[model samples]
Target: MTMPIILPRQEAPVAAIATPVGVGALAVLRISGEGVFDIAQKVFRKKNNPNFRFTASKGFRAHFGTVHDSEGLIDEVVALVFRSPNSFTMEDMVEFTCHGGPVVVQHILKVLLDEGCRLAEPGEFTRRAFLNGRIDLLQAEAIGEMIHARTESAFRTAVTQMQGTLSLRLDAMRELLLRSCALLELELDFSEEDVEFQSRTQLQEELAGLQEELHRLVDSYQHGRLLKEGVATVIAGLPNAGKSTLLNVLLGEERSIVSHMPGTTRDYIEECFLYEKTMFRLTDTAGLREGGEEVEHEGIRRSFKKISEADLLVYLLDISLESYLDEVPLIRDLLERNSNARMIVAANKIDLATGSEERLQKLRAATGCEVCALSAAKGEGLEALKRLMSTMVEGLDKLHEASVLVTSLRHYEALRNASDALANAQELITRQAETELIAFELRSALDYVGEITGKVVSEEIVNLIFEQFCIGK
Candidate 1:
């Protein structure tokens, strides 16, 4: 097996409050790198053994001591130690677990900083883990996403990726490609012997199978990306509609200002909500109108711009103004321009309008768009709306498909480039082009695919990837 590349050490002192810094039962300050134990021991005094030497202690051990400064004993804490090469960063590491309080945590961190330990940069710890062979670039990215997971779906997706399902699949594909490359090389050397290392028909069959699998994974990203990042949903309607009320009820908060005044919301207001396992960003936009204040008109313009960019648009209609249902021409134009977006007709104020049920059926039949009748103010019929949003994202049929998905845009882009290159390679092979030309196209395809899993990525890309992570990762 070939050894993977390990990043060169750009060593620096690093320390952070491993535990949150708020008032809690306990907090931990972690320090790792050269002289970790020695520097910690200088400030830590054990009640039992005042002269306790931590640097001389055996690796993978723990000790109890009181952290003292010139002001005397600061706090009694436990220190866990890990020796070099066996630790997370492949450097000596010490964890100081102390009582959780703003003052105590701050004082402990101050002592370590004063003792020559610098504060860790965002994701410095995990970056070290990547450099030390503790995990691969894909796993490192998974860890970062896992930390920021906001919904059950996002959490599960990140966990699945971090657990190595995606990694295992990628590794298997790479192994198959490597085997094919080796056979091709062998055929080049023993052409006169007429030995068939990999028959043309067999190779083509395997290639076809791999390509189909890759396409399936690539297709999955549409839903996977939505699950990870949430869909941009813009709620739009006429003046005095319950768009704001519906947004607050769905988010369970007063995220958008509500009032009886027409065009009250002159600008877009957004908030995120969790519906079952998925996340949806609901934006209550300015009510559509022809004549209004200059500012209100600008808001309407911005609202239209948002509608164009939205993944889903909620065309809200105030049932109380059922007479305005004939004004659907404006909405028809909006939909015509944004033909790619999924539009759902929302009949708001059902509690006030007695004719809403008939109006909803008529609108749905005439516009050929999904319709839901719900009273936003009374919080009635919201469940059906949530279900519709989920369905529009990806039909219920694909909901329970295997959890493995390509969620990274970087991976999606790489797969697309590789797929195009493979198509070209197949064409070349079919023409019986020079062997060297086929090999060159195959090599290009391989390189493009390698970018997806960091098999052939630059150090700059790795740094940018880590930059997205938080500290203490």
Candidate 2:
């Protein structure tokens, strides 16, 4: 729960349009830092209450008012008041709710600046919240995630993070690391006296247990990624295997051109499809074949790249064709290339006479994986196919139910580094190495974990994290 040792930042009162810049009913302009209320009062005139002073107003109170500039009579507004140490940045804050027209927002923001408020930088508000210890770096990033979240699942996860659930978990882990690091440092201090602050046996046990926990958190990244950025699913097969057809059906739109001719889809078409709580970034790839034209080759190359990066691979097959089993080798190749991606062999065109249960059994036998039989054209048995798609990412729902998940790649990488450092410390301890060596490794692990929650991080990394956020946030 301790604050990070971040650099001191300016306490200048800053202002910015806190809402999206557009024509809307209302636009909110946020101002935070020292002396914000005084700056706001200069631009805002309380309606029929000239005697009302923002300085005299209670925190969280609002005053109906009109804003003005040197030009005069800028716009009618409602001034929201939040006092120092009780606001977002733990500083005096005020928000002007004015007409949402871009011009009005600009005018109001300009008047505030003219009143001595500096323009807020991108994410400066949230940055202040972090710098002032109102929220951790992880929680700050979570706020950005919540704002940009497209799916309900992603939004829910971000909400949990913003609520400091993950922060609490990381803080617990940090406490453990800090305790061990402190003990090791104590051992180093009394090296001359040969005093052991901690037993090597117990230390090794704790390191092993901590490392295991780190590994567990690291493993959650995949499911956590699925929550944050939908599953990268590629629908792949030989030409005319109904890859595009399946995509069109799943998306309920003719997103890709369907043709009897091969290589009709010379490029990949990507769309987002939400099934239950999980989102599938369905990519219909260019049909795979040997010796296609140069242009097709480039498309094929891109297709393979997408396939390689896929989290879920759906190998669609036109089971009605005599050469349908000929696709078996292609499916096997895809499985080999994308071994990390969960796969489903979709036996398409089951409405055709030859599309039979026995053919699906043969596919299952050849691929050593279950086959989903369906007709993308007729849209038959697609519910089962959709269910199979969900099954490929099984445990996703349960993962969503879990409180803690490492959705951010930044967090995952930090955890991985921490785990590596802990492993090194384990080796050093087992080797009966000098206390200083073990302590160094433990500190490295400690800092790595601290980076996630902003306990120990550089100014550059802090800037980089906030840079991704929009100005208002």
Candidate 3:
């Protein structure tokens, strides 16, 4: 009989204050690992039974207790116990619900530390969960996303990811690839016999379908990233173009210092607001013009940089100004420079202009982009602008409908690599390349797919993924 090989545990017993540090009704301190009950036994005293054994306590049971140091009692608390192999991290875990206070929580932590519990590093708890097979790297990242989510859509997307929506899809793709690779391996094994486990045509068709699926996932990264990190929408134009006013109106608050004076906004001001469940990071940039003071020139330089980096540009043109046509050349130059960025030409000060339709139409023709006529000062036509903004982000409507999306750059890159490898394998089959070469490419594709679900990931990559997590997660 062969003996089972036991992998050595990589982590020590750890403890941390799980709750935010401040005056609250209650605070939770978490402890997990082997011998956690022994550590709990030393610090926690049962309210009714002084001689109670923590190790013998039933798993998932809560006990009223008091935490005491060597000198005396630290805080009256409730201890929740979770036994090994069933709890998060698959280790004996305990959580103490103590009165919320800085002094009390600190003393409780100190007692646990003195009793041999090491303080948990940032993201250590979630890292342990990943290491112990409770959650994969994608779920771990989803946890972080849920924590930092700024919009309802972002939160929902994170929750879906945490529930393994993306994982299930990746797993299915990997299984298919594994089956295909297995057939290739069989052919390799019987090279002399020239037996075909699966026909080359069949393999090619299957790989083509998998590649198409991967292509869709890879294509989702742009909108996924935009949803994750709010869209970088820059409001830019010449000075006194109502850029700041537009920002203030959109936010429904006086976030920026709006003034009639030229060059009042010497730098950029940014704020995020949700519209149609999508978060738009609106930036009010300094006026773009030539021949300004040194500081103004620097500000103008920064405004151009913002324009270049923006996902969408809201170029505000003061319709009342005769020099608006002069500004047309500058806008054309900017559009040429940032060809990838989406543009919405806003003909501002429409309330002040008489018969602005002809000019608006000319503006639309000149820029050859979506144009909106609005009075930022009077808050007119803002609703239409908002609607347009919501429509700008592709697939916003399908966000809730889609079961899986490629949100992480890591996942996107892995999928692209897998797709490329599978494509190479398909080409090799068409050319009747060596079975060994085809098998090698298929194996490469399989490894890339495995990396997404953490089935074949390196320790360094795992650590890096979890490092984004907060302590006591």
Candidate 4:
């Protein structure tokens, strides 16, 4: 057995509001530590009693009050107290429900700050919740995810994580690992007696199962990241395809300049939309057309560059035009360049077209991409387009269930490295290499899994994780 690593000890006071700072009905300010209530009482005042003893209050009880400074009353507020070990941070926590004006919130926070509390860093509140044993690292991350989730489906997955679904699954895997480690340690103890703690077949089976589970989790990162972040979609087509109008209708706002002139949009425009619980960043780029002005031609060049990075390409066709000359060749060339990118052939301006079903059929038959007939100007057939986009992004549910989707690039890289090490170790095992080499591979694989939940992480890695968070998470 290896000696456990001793982590650095750094305890500090932290305070921040649990709600957004705005002119609303109320804002919740949370302070957690050994002496949070006493700090609150120093500045808090009740109408009937000039002095209120905040620390003496029973747990979870609310106290009506007006917060004050030396000059005058700052704002009317209600305070809720939670005692140690029973609170979110397992420390004495005080919550202030004050009027939600920015000035009022700042003043209240100032009071706490003056009383020796430090400004909470982004995710500090949840970090404390994690350190205090109320939740694990996964749940801590889930809290942040739930706070920022854009769509209902994304929110639901975060909620599932918060409910311990992910933690429970990880815990099961950890248990198996712990058992295997214990059995390996026992082999060292009984090696002189030539007694087997676990048979070779049993060890192989256990390793295979553990490897399978790790790969599944590593795979889930793909779907998880898609749900967490969003898909980048690029809109490409000839000028006057109503791509701008399509972008506006999908976003429910006129975020882009809409004009009938060809090459009106000379730069890429971006907007975000949610469809079927998934988020998508829609990039409306300059129309791909020949013989444009130099500036417009440069814009078209950048549009193709953006198309290369896109997860999906939406090819718009203006059916009202006399002929779709530019698109047929442009799309064929794009497909040749990016064979893996999902492409959708959308026949725009369907409402204005003159019996364009034949044109739509011709376009669809030529490209062999997913096709949708719609009018971006009239908001026609948009729901169908949205549904198709969701399907393309999520893929078939059956595939997701059958294989693990790697969501985070961090997790994916780690898994790939771990898999490589495992394969090396397996080859060495077949060659009857020394026990130390096999053990090294096992430990390396374990450390890779730990990176996902931040176990045994370095200070630099922790800093990287926290840096990704917003200031007031």
What are the lDDT figures for the candidates, one per model?
0.80, 0.87, 0.87, 0.75
- State the displacement of the C-alpha of residue 23, model 1, in Å, after optimal TM-score superposition: 1.7
How much is 276 displaced in model 1, in angstroms?
A: 3.2
Pairs in clash, predicted candidate 2: none
For candidate 4, lDDT tens digit of each residue in 1-473?
A: 99974432234556887787568988888887766877888878866876568767789888888888777889898988887767777777888899888888998888888887888887776666666557766666677678788877567777887777766765666566566656666766776876667565776777777677767776676566666667788888888888999999999998989898989899899877877667898999998878988999899989988888787889898877777644677788888777657899898888888878888778878778888999888888999999998888777233456222444466567666666666665676678665556667766766666665666456676566555655445
Clash pairs, candidate 3, are none
TM-score per model over all chains: 0.86, 0.90, 0.88, 0.83
Candidate 2 per-residue lDDT, tens place, 47-107, comes to 8888988899999998998988877898888889887677888778898888889998988
Taking every candidate in turn, the Cα RMSD to the unseen true structure, in Å, is 3.8, 3.5, 3.4, 4.6
lDDT score, residue 319, model 1? 68
Candidate 1, lDDT over the whole model: 0.80
Clashes of each: 0, 0, 0, 9
Cα displacement (Å) at residue 443, model 4: 0.9
For candidate 3, write residues 1-473 as lDDT tens digits: 99985542646799999999899999999998878899999998998798899888889999997998888988899999987766777778999999999889999998998989999988888888888877888898899899989887678889999999888888899899899889889888899999889898888889899998898888777667777888889999989999999999999999999888989899899999888777899999999878989999999999999999888889998998766667778888888878868888898999998879988888877778799999999999999998887787654435424456777889989999999999899899999998889999999999999998899999888888877777888
Question: Can you rank all candidates by TM-score, best first?
Answer: 2, 3, 1, 4
Judge candidate 4 at residue 242 and give its lDDT: 89
Residue 109 of model 3 has an lDDT of 92
Please report the TM-score between candidate 4 and the true structure. 0.83
Give the least accurate 10-residue stretch of model 1, judged by summed lDDT.
Answer: 394-403
